[model samples]
Target: MKPEFENTPLVKAGKRFEIEIDGHFAFIDYREMGHQIALVHTETDPELAGTGAATAVVEKTLAYIEENGKKLLPFCPYVFAYIKKHPDWKRIVDERFEGYNKL
Candidate 1:
């Protein structure tokens, strides 16, 4: 059975890492550029893949950015691809921020 991840929370693990399921993490790597958080890398376990967990992480990260009035730098390939596919969140993006082409 697919894991129920709709209610999972994005928990910050460190300065440049965050995870969804405690030790069973969906890889996340990011850097803080001034007030913005630049996504370096993000991935979900193969077993948890395609379940929208990564999207949840992005949503939570965006919310965190919004709450802090900061911008987003989606450098992670997965995240970059996600935003590229979902233009609705473009408003939260800081084009002036670095790491855009890094995707």
Candidate 2:
């Protein structure tokens, strides 16, 4: 089963992006520091929750980061939790975004 999201854009940069999907769009804002990608925000429509949209967006985002040979500062809680769930991705996670590490 899937949601009715199949033609939406994810991560637009000045009207362009490294990836795009359909139906529902995933919004992500970023800042570059040296060679790292600071993921400022990530969100999908509320109606798209639990429909694999989040994971798809995260995966696409990660792929972009990898292709660019950059690290990630996952500021978005959703991406942070996704990182936790996929520990293999820990290597790409910039320590600066680990705000809860000290707590």
* Best model per lDDT: 1
Query: 49-99 in candidate 1: lDDT tens per residue?
Result: 676667777767767777788888776777777777777767778877565
- Model 2 over residues 1-103: C-alpha lDDT tens digits? 1343334434547522333444545556677788888877776677666667667777777777877889888877877888777887777776666563621
Candidate 2 vs. true structure, TM-score: 0.70
Cα lDDT of candidate 2 equals: 0.66
In candidate 2, stretches whose alpha carbon ends up further than 4 angstroms from where it belongs are: 1-12, 15-22, 96-103
Per-candidate TM-scores read 0.74, 0.70
